[model samples]
Target: MSKLVLSELTLSHFRSHKRATVALDGRPIAIFGPNGAGKTNLLEAVSLLSPGRGMRRAGADDLTRRPEALGWKITAILGSLHQTHELETWAEAGNPRQLRIDGKAAPQVALGRIARILWLVPSMDRLWIEGAEGRRRFLDRATLSFEPTHADAVLSYEKAMRERNRLLKDMVRDPHWYSAIEAQMAEAGATIQRNRQDTIVQLMAAQNAAPTAFPTANLTLTSPDPIPDDLQMALADNRGRDMAAGRTLIGPHRADLDAVFAEKGTLARDCSTGEQKALLISLILANGRALARDFGAPPILLLDEVAAHLDATRRAALYDEIDALGAQAFMSGTGPELFSELDDRAQYIEVTETDRESVVMQRTSL
Candidate 1:
C-alpha cells in the first residue's frame, strides 16, 4: 500500500498562527473551524510542500501572520515504508522563500520527487462556469502530479513564447532571431502537448475503472488553433501570421480542456450545478488514482470546504474511496459532523482564532 503520513507539524508566524506545533496520527485528517479562523492556511502550508504555488497562490507577503509578524516557517515529518523524511519551507523577514529537505537546501521541483500535493479549494466551485484559466490550471496541476518534469517543460515553453512575442512586436523580420526561439518553443511545446495528452488518457482510464459515487468526466484537450503533429512545420506555418499578431498563436499555450458528463453526455458547463461539482470531484479522484498507478503513490490531497458542497451520501462514498486508496487526504469544513462517516478511520483537528493568535489542535482521534 502507498501512504504518506504527517507525524508532526510546526508553524511560526504563519497566517494567524504565531507559533504552533500539532502532532498527528496515522489516518486521514479532518479540520473544522469557523470562517477567518485560519483553517485554510494550514492546508496552504501543506500544499507548499509540492512544487509551484500553494492552493491559494498567495504571494509571500500575504502568508505572513497578522500585525507584529516577521515571517513564517513550517516543518513536517512525512512517513512512508517505516522511514521518515523531514521537510521545511520558510520565508524570512521580507525575503524570498526557501525550502529545506533534511536540513539541506533544495530546488522547488525537487520536492515533487519526494512529495506530491493536490487540492480542491472552495473557489473552484465556479470552475466549470468560470473562465478557462482556472480549468487550465486544474489540468496542469494534474499533469504535474504524474510527471514532475512537466514543470520544466512549462517554464521553458512559456519563456520561449515570451521572447518570441517580444520579437514579433519589434517587427524583427530576421529569421535568425526568431528561429532559435521558435525551435525552443517547438521542442518544449511538443513535450507539453504530449504530457497533457498522456495525462488525459490516464485520467480517462481511471475514471472508467473507478467505482465511486462521483460522476465521471469525459475530458479532452481543446484548442482554438489545431496543434500540428509536426512542431517545426506548425511553427513555420504560423510564423508570418504570428509576427503580424505579435504572438505565437498555434502552440500548447492556447490549449483548453473540455469536460463532459460521461454518462449523460452533457458538457460540464451545461450540467446542473450539483452535477458540475460532482464531475470536478470525480476528475480529481481520477487524477489521484492515475498518479498512484503511474508513480507508485497517490499525491497528497487537500479538499477545502469539501463537505459543504457534497451531500451526505456522496461524502460517505468519497471518504470510503479515499480510505480504500490509502491516500492521505486533508479535508476542511465548518464542523466535525461532516466527517462523521469517517468513523475511526480518520484524524480530526480543530482550527480557531483565539486571544490574538491562531491555533490548530488535535481535538479528537477518529
Candidate 2:
C-alpha cells in the first residue's frame, strides 16, 4: 500500500516554538511533556498542513509568537502515495493565511487533495453533550477527510447563507434577489448533505466490517426541522420565516450528528465519560480504516493527549491498532509513562519549556 507521511516539518515563529524542525520516518510519533510544554503546538502545526484553521481554531494573530507577535509559518515535506511534495503555509502580520505547493502559490483547498488529516482532541471529549455546532464540525471534518471537495461546498454554502441572512436582516422582500442566492445555497447545501451522509455510511460499514476493542457507534444525521427535498424552494418558501428569524433557518448548517452505542443501544450523550471517549475513538479508527481501504493510505492522525485518557490495556490496544494500520499517528501526553505501551513501535519525542522557550528533543528511534 502507498503511504502518506510528513517526512519533515519546520515551524518558524509559531506559538511557543520560535524555530523548530523535525525529520520523521512515518512511524507513529509519541510526544510527552509537562503541562504547558507546547506539545499540542506541534500537532497544531501538522493540522495547518491541511485545510481550515488549525486545531486550536485560533485566528492568525493568535498563532503568532508573543512579545514579537510576528507572523507564523509552517513548512512540511509531505510524502503521499509514494510521491513527495513541499507544502508551505504562513501568515504575515495577521494577514490571511497563504499556501504554497512545490514553492508555487496554491489555494487552501488544494492541500486536501495531497494530504488527508484526522484528529481526536481533548476538547472533543464532550462532543456528545455539547451543542450541535461542535458535532456538526466534527462530522464535517470526517466528511472532508473522505471528500476534499466537501470544504469547497461548505465554504460556498456558508457564503450564500451569509448573504441570504444579510438580505433577510435588511427585510428584503424581492423574489429575484432571493432566487439566485437560494439556488446557490441549495446546490451547495445538497452536496454538503450528500457528502455527510456518504461519510456516515462509510463509517458504519467500516465499524461493522472490522472488529475492534473500541465500542461501535451507530451514527445518523438529523436536523431540528424536516429537511426539504427541494432546498431551493424551501429557502424561497421560508424566506418570510427566515426574515423574522434573521438567518437562513433550514439547511445543512442546522444539521446534527446523533450517535448511539451500537451494542448497548444507549445515546452517546448518556454514556459514561469513558464510554463516550471510547465511542469517539471507535469512530476515528473506523474512519481511518475506511480511508485506508479507499485511498490506498491511511491519514496522518493527530491524537492530542489521548493516551492519558485511556487505561493501559486500552492504550495498548489503540497503539496496536494504529501500528497494524501502518498509520503515522502523532499522539501527545503529559508524561512519558503515558506512552509506555507503544515502547519500540513508535518514535518518542520529549518537549520541554525552559526560559519561556519550547524545545523538542527526539528520545527514541523507529
Candidate 3:
C-alpha cells in the first residue's frame, strides 16, 4: 500500500461539483474525462487537505457553488503512515473557512503536521516566464512541506510587513512606531529564509540520490539586493528610503528563486515549454522523495493536466517513478489513453458534465 493516501473524498457545492464522492485505495489515481468534467476539482479538494487556500488560491466566497451560493464542504479520510485521520473543512456562504480534524476543531497549520500535500497546476506553466511572485510561492510551498511551522513564520512576517508598509505609506517618521514592527519582521524573515534554503538543499540531494527520466535543476535562492546581517538595523537604516517609496523593501518579500536546467546548463527561463514542464515534474517528484524520509511517508501529489504535456515514454517513466517512490499521486487528463501506461498500477475515476454540474460517473479498476 502507498504510505500516504486519501482513502475517501467527498465534495459538496464546490465549483462545478454539486456533490461527488470517491473511494480510493493506496495507489496512484487516474482521473480522466472530457474537458470541464471536474477532474481538477477533485484534486483541488485534496489540495485543501493541507494548508493554504487549495491549489487555485481561491477565496471561500469564490469556492461557493454559484446560483446556490450556499458555500461548500469537503471531507476526507487520510491515511498517513499507519494512522488514519478524519478531516473536514467547510465555509458558510461568505464566511471564512473552518477546519476540523478527527472530529475536533483545529487550525489549518495543524493539518500540515498530518498531511504533506504538493501540487502543480496548468496555470503554473508560466512559472519561469512570469514574475518572481509565483516562483517564491512555489519555493515557500516546498519549504512549508518540510517545516509545518513555516506557515506561522510566513504569516508573522507578512503581517508585520503590512503594518510597516502602512506606516511608510502614512509617512510616519517616529522611530518608536517602527521599532517593534521591524523586530518582528526581522525575526520571522530570518526563519523564512533559513527554512527555504533547507528545502532547496533537501530537493537537490534527493535528485542526485536517485536517477529518473526527468532532468535535474540547479536551484538558487536570490534577492534583488544583498540581505544584511542585521535585518532590524537594515530596516531602520532604510526607513527614509522606504518612506519615499511608500513600502518596505529589501527583505525575503523581494527574494526570488532561480533555476537552471542542470543537464543543459541553461536557465529554466530559456528552456522549451516541454523541457520546463519536465523540470517541474522532476522537482515535484524529488520533493515527494525527500518528504518520504522527513515525514515518514511520501506526499500526496496533485498533478493536473500533466500527462498531456509529456510523451508516451516520459509518461510511462513518470508512473514508474511514482510507483518506486510509493506515493499516491492524483493525476488528471482529458482521455484515458494519456494514462494507459498506468494499466493495473492505477485506479481510474471517470467524471462527466451534465447541465453545468460535474458528476462522478464511476470508478473502475483495471
User: Candidate 1: where are CA atoms >4 Å away?
Assistant: none
Residues 1-366, model 3: lDDT tens digits: 338888899999998999998888888999989998888989999998998998999998888787899989999999887889999999998699999999999999999988999999998888998999999999999999999999899999999999999999999999999999999999999999899999999999999999899999999999988788789999999999999999987899999999999989999999999999999999999999999999999999999999857999999999999999989899999998898888899999888999999989656753
For all predicted structures, in order, the TM-scores are: 0.96, 0.98, 0.98
In model 2, the runs with Cα more than 4 Å from the true position are none
Task: Record all residue pairs in model 2 with backbone atoms less than 3 Å apart, i.e. clashing.
Answer: none
The TM-score, computed over Cα atoms with residue i paired to residue i, of candidate 3 is 0.98
**For every candidate, C-alpha RMSD to the true structure in Å:** 1.5, 1.2, 1.2
In terms of lDDT, model 3 sits at: 0.92
Error of 3 at 189 (Å): 0.7
For residues 237-346, write the lDDT of model 2, one tens digit per residue. 89989999999889999999999999999999999999999999999999999999988899999999897568899999999999988999999998888888877888
Candidate 1 lDDT over residue span 1-366, tens digit each: 566677888888988888888787757889998888888888888898888779988777788887865988889998754468899998877887899988899999988887777899988888888887788788888899888999899999999889888988998887888778878988998999999999899999999997878888888899987888887677876778988887888888888999989889999999887888888888888888887777777778899998866789999999998987788889999888899999889888898888977777887664
Superposed Cα deviation of residue 344, candidate 1 (Å) = 1.8
Residue 168's lDDT within candidate 2 is 98
